[model samples]
Target chain A: MDYSGNGKQFSGKVVTVTSGKGGVGKTTLTANLAAALAADGQKVVCIDGDIGLRNLDVVLGLENRIVYDLVDVVEGRCRLRQAMIRDKRLPELYLIPAAQTRDKNAVSPSDMIRLTNELRPEMDWILIDSPAGIERGFRNAIAPADIVLVVTNPEVSAVRDADRIIGLIEAEEKGPARLVINRIKPAMVKRGEMLSMEDVLELLAIELIGLIPDDEGVVTSSNRGNPIAIEGKSKAAQSFRNIAQRLQGHKVPFLELQEDGNLFGRLARLLRPGGN
Target chain B: MHAVLIKPGTDRNGMEISTKFQIKGIREGLLVTLGDAPWEQVYAALIEHLDEQRDFLKGARLALDVGNHMLKAADLGQIRNQISERDLTLWAVISNSPTTERTAQTLGLETRLSKPKPEPAAQDTRYQDGDPAILVHRTLRSGYSLQNPGHVVILGDVNPGAEIISGGDVIVWGRLRGMVHAGAGGNESAVICALDLAPTQLRIAGVIAITPQRRGKSQPEMVRILNGQVVAEPWNPKKKD
Candidate 1:
């Protein structure tokens, strides 16, 4: 099973943000990636693949506005158009909110593929937030994905989960998966309390796409339903924005995550015009 | 005396000609098709062809592709004994004519090509293009397997659980701690080498070796079949100089 990175150009690209372990920020990356892609004027749709415990609505600040969930649309109770909850802020951004009442078995891989093919003609990106573990939900998430991005934190346990995910992805022929090491704490790494980027890269041995440092603003922004990439500036926001740009085919240099406050300057961060 | 066996004007002298190309090599260490002519001339041409490609045809896998020549197993066995006198093997008889094929099968001669052509990697321009094998310039991790019929030279490590099964030699620039089988078709001369010669299992031709744990650090090592057993020794291409 080998997935060549061949389907990245044109049409709607499905990037499944998956991690094998829970609480490793799969939803955060999904929510932010959706926002990041939409912020660039590309029409984007985020499918919350965690069927029973959906969070794309809450993360994208559309929880109260959800009229119908993914299962309703999949089971044909409602039109496919009725289930998509559009974000008011970003005209190009939409969310096909997950079903809370039912489990992941509510949608199948074929169903996901059909849904994605329908969305393909209208959108530029469809980011699937895959549920944790190598189960049916994970299979459904990656079923329609053109590129699989394995997200993990810079910790031993998170890395183990990522390795397992990478193995599974390769077996599905859905990979040569790229890695996104999220929630990297530079200070902890410097103090040797956390795993370094090199250590994680060594074990994973996959091409790293982005390294997002742990930021306090991420939680507050999630609480308010606006991703940090669009709001108050942080290294993490720039990281996500750079990732979005990279997804759009721009090659961006990696940001050096250093927290010693020393004279050695970090790589230039691309500050967008929206905010500081 | 034998002028009547000739077709009138074609050769008044009645001199026989066996001019078609003969691939008289062993199919599985057996002398297969020698040139097929009229029965007596066919045997004569076979003897002559054996004398010409003497060194190149030595000890090869051979099968005879006799076109419509029907002969009893005793007759074929007699010819085989003759070839065996010269250390040639008669393995298979490939024949379009049913009688000969049946006879060859009865004599236990293989009748078909071994297998279909090997399937190379997808997205490999070299798979369809002329390059037989491509150089992989990185380490092969666990669960990563490479299947190439041509020689495979890796510039990095082959970790445990990884495999490199090649139809030719496999040379690893770094540590080789994985399973590697070279000359997979039983070519005994194929050699495997690495900076740290510590494979979970090493195979060359029909011989296999398990690298014993060394007490000291790793050194460059090479493995080859010696006296019909796989043996690994220190690799020092420069130490001799």
Candidate 2:
């Protein structure tokens, strides 16, 4: 809660999570990643860049603590500290909720650059949850990012939109973006009814950072406004934590996500630990 | 009636639009340089000048050099509509500010004008012969477009949403998965060749064709107009057409 360590000069790395298609897990990943990083004792801040359609605060379980939003800080209506709401559980984590009534055009890309620049020196990580299109909101979120994480589902349409988003990020010189495939069903993939990790990776041709399996715990946790990465022992939670470790420059192997509970599967898991 | 005389030594008589606007002839029609006035005053002067020389400026391609004025998308969109209504095409918008350039790009307007290059002799003699072709070495990602008056050769993949439009032949050394149009200026003899020829849509001259899903591994293929129908043939080195 105390941000008065101005003498410590820790410039934070800004990471923006964006997906071109709506209903992708951009907000969810941002919330969990911030929580996981904060749980590791790293000071992190999450900014909801989707102005008119804010969801990061709700996903982070900090919707009730909103005193001032992003637009209030950008438009100079409030100071930066007043708009940042600290998480109840993790003292190192903060949330800057978006203004629900204001549209995307209310905030410009330069304003986002200026805002993140002000927050860069105090925190260890600044995560921006981008809106679902390649328009003003997406541009605003990526303008200040040192790294961009493109989240996508395993479906064809989501992958197509993710391709477009990756191209746009490359065009804006913020690429090449790391990929995080969410809501993947390993059972369906095994049955050849869904896209496997290899298929998505071949099409996207980007570096893979995280591969999250489809879990019902994610939905339940979201409804309860608690991130699954905080305490849950689900595979999805472990994937988020592994991604955080990867972002921190640790070499963590990808999790093997096959749901076959046979002896061979268990032996394979033992043979190649964290092998995909 | 104040007779605004066009300046001498210029090829076009509509060279001088006004004091605030300087219009000159370039390879791509007219290039207008706007003065360092406020947005409203400059816009007013531009519209007035365009209206005054309506006859001579009709159907002309214009490239506006807007000095450090940081105009938004709405401002650029309004001026583009106005120019289009006056029968003048605004092909490019040159700006000193990065914000304005990005706004222009988002509106699908070119921000830079390529310098005029020497025309190849084959372009004037025969359309099928070797013409000056541009070589792009990088992958054309989605939302990126490459258009040329001659031929285009890409050494990388053309992803799903990218596009390539050429007046002559189109050749891809790598996969061609996006939309491509060859002989866009109505030359049917133009052909498109790719290592893996699976495009969302392909057009040559006035004919359009879509590739069906390949059952197995893809091979190098060539597509062209054969007997008034677009046909794809395997690129055989020994076979001569």
Candidate 3:
């Protein structure tokens, strides 16, 4: 569990969480994963790659304390350490918020590479929160990633966009990217009303890292500027912590989300004996 | 004309600027062919040339023919931004390098200057006798496209959102779920066949058809123009056409 670097030759692994479709819970997942890793005693820093529409700071509840942003570091207006705001709860966790006033074109891919290279020496893990779409911002977020995690909802459109993003990643030689299915509703999936995890994995053909069930507490905790991974014991929080453990080369079993239906449905299934 | 010749002579640093590029007007817009120099030098010269002719080349749809330059996504993306800053739309990028072509396609830029050419006239017996075919061994994922003048034989799955446009027949040894246009050049004799013939859309010459959903497990099927309508039937060895 100790990923801390030795006294010399210490470099962190950069993991970027990206979803081609918007509002698929990328910022939420990034915040929770950072919190989970930091809670595990690993030094983690999260970068908000979405410039004009920054949300990672707000999600992590470090919005008001941010004196400098990522653009300031890239443009040499502020030192790299000056822009990183340490979390109040987890002393090991830090966040480098995006510039709200600048657009995506403000930072180039090489700038991102340089910035992450500067942060690699001191941290155990660096996670980048990528914006939606396969544009400049997405490219910048993924430029320096040692691992890419693609998040997608089980809907057809989101899966389609994820497919496109996976293809692009392959073309850039950044793959094979891992899959993280967020906001999954097991009840609807069991009723044939939504796409199952198998359906998504069949199309994407990538390794699965985590399956996070839908939880309302996730939204409330995010709104309260506290990540669920640190504050709540919800399934979504456990899912994020499991993913962090997996990233650290630990073997964690995937959660059995299908058994999370209503009590009556579970009893009926148990009585029916092998009746799906 | 002579005054324009001296424009690309030398910079203030006394560095000889080799701004060798040819600009031609095409149906789409301007096609700029850059010479084989170092990427940095050529890029700087191209930008300088554009800036010099700002009024003339402004608002033009440009297709750059970068000869054999193995450009990556970062390189292509940078040039795209530079091109856009000069008020030009970079729609396509023509390159001899496969890596560069794939990079351009991933960025949603066109790799070919024109669509697949129409088939030659019926009287041209030479072309009919020697129709070429290209064999692809890898799976064609989403957002990837394959366009050929002759037949296209794929040994892998054609996922949805991918496409194939061929002048001759199209055959897939694996599952086919993408769009396939056989007889793209008005050859109605072209046939499309696959182990799983569930394509997003199928076309033969000028006609297009959507494959009806299958009831049971999929079987090998072939689609062709039957009486001016596109029809698909299971491939039966003993049955006569």
**Top candidate by TM-score:** 3
lDDT of 3 by residue, A171-207 (tens): 6678889999998888876655567787688778889
- The list of candidate 2 runs beyond 4 A from truth reads A1-9, A260-276, B1-91, B94-108, B111-130, B238-241
Model 2 C-alpha lDDT per residue in residues B59-166, reported as the tens digit of each score: 999999998889887688668757866778898999999779866865667988873232333433236466678888777767777777788999988877889888
DockQ, candidate 3, comes to 0.26
Name the regions of candidate 1 deviating beyond 4 angstroms: A1-10, A259-276, B1-241
- Model with the higher DockQ, candidate 2 or 3: 3
**What is candidate 3's lDDT per residue for B47-90, written digit by digit as tens?**
98789889988899999999878899878877886787677889
Which candidate, 1 or 3, would have the higher DockQ against the true structure?
3
lDDT of each residue in A1-276, candidate 1, tens digit only: 223135744577888989888888889888888888888888999999999988878888999999987899888999888988889989889999998989977787778889999988888888999999877798789878888889999877777678767766765557778889888877666655667677677667888888898998898888888888875478999998878877777888878678556311121111111110
Residue-level error in angstroms, candidate 3, position B141: 3.1
Q: lDDT of candidate 3?
A: 0.84
Which residue ranges in model 3 land beyond 4 Å of their true spot?
A: A1-9, A260-276, B1-31, B38-62, B70-90, B97-103, B120-130, B236-241
For DockQ, the strongest prediction is: 3
| lDDT (Cα, 0-100) at A177 in candidate 1 | 88
Q: Tell me which residue pairs clash in candidate 2.
A: none
- What DockQ, between 0 and 1, does each candidate earn? 0.02, 0.17, 0.26
What lDDT is reached at residue B58 by model 1? Answer: 77
Error of 1 at B214 (Å): 14
Residue B91, candidate 3: C-alpha displacement in angstroms: 3.4
